[model samples]
Target: MRNAMTGLALLLALLLASGGAAGAADFPLAGTWTLTAADRITPAGVREPDYGAAPKGRLIVDATGRYSLQIFKSERTGFASGDKKRGTPQEYADAALGSSTHYGTIAIDAAAHQLVFRIEGASFKNWEGTTQRRAYDLKGDRLSYRVPTAPDGNVPVSEWRRER
Candidate 1:
């Protein structure tokens, strides 16, 4: 009986050591996020759809407030391609004719919980070089992000739920 009890106690100790508390959502946003929608707010305050390759890429943010972001912009607009994901030389030529690109940069304000994203490289052609900055909020199992208006009386709002 004494030996059995001792063995049981040792097993319980090992289990407790290995099973720890759940971690905070501190570093989960270190992956690629695709752009679901990009809106072009006309001067009349009416929002329109400006087509481009779906903005897709990865974001690597370190704990020290340094990060790298790579996002693929619209690709199909200026090409006559034989395959998807890669365009033929002619397709490349065509795509360049219209001159469209896609990219995103991100900086986080942990104290204020705001996310500053500077987008350029062809995505801002419609916005006339204005880098849109938005408020970012994150809670347990919930993420909320908002973009303020362009002062032209039109604003775009975006929300992202945890992927998993």
Candidate 2:
């Protein structure tokens, strides 16, 4: 009887230590987050603002592991032709450089604490059908992550706050 009690105690202790007895939540990142700030840092320690000071964007992650994000500068000018489809080359170039959008599925690596985005479609032509791994942190209502460096040697960082 004493040996059985000792074994039971050991099992209980293991369960408590491993945190496996209380099942973990499945969807920790399922919510809408709005971008609060974005900045780019160069390898030479130069810092540049990204998407302007008061950028507008939304990031939505659904329970089904799908995600979409859009970020844009607030001061973008309207197309010269007053129509999106008829925008001149310069207007189209300005819009493309000033905004970003992507949608795809996300895979979380709990051990590594990183989110892998398997991008299906993106406004930036080069990013479509690409996979990007971003290290992320979630604290209270804030989420922050770093984007892979751009061709211009700038590393982008973005912070988002949960929407309600």
Candidate 2: how many backbone clashes? 0
TM-score of each: 0.39, 0.80
TM-score of 2: 0.80
Candidate 2 lDDT score relative to the true structure? 0.85
The C-alpha stretches of model 2 lying farther than 4 A from their native spots are 1-25
Q: Per-residue CA lDDT of candidate 2, range 83-137, in tens? A: 9999988788779878999999987887988888999999987889999998888
lDDT of 1: 0.51
Candidate 1, residue 15: Cα displacement in angstroms equals 26
As a whole number from 0 to 100, the lDDT of residue 156 in candidate 2 is 91
Which one is best on TM-score?
Answer: 2
Instruction: Name every residue pair that clashes in candidate 2.
Output: none
Q: What 10-residue stretch in candidate 2 is worst by lDDT?
A: 18-27
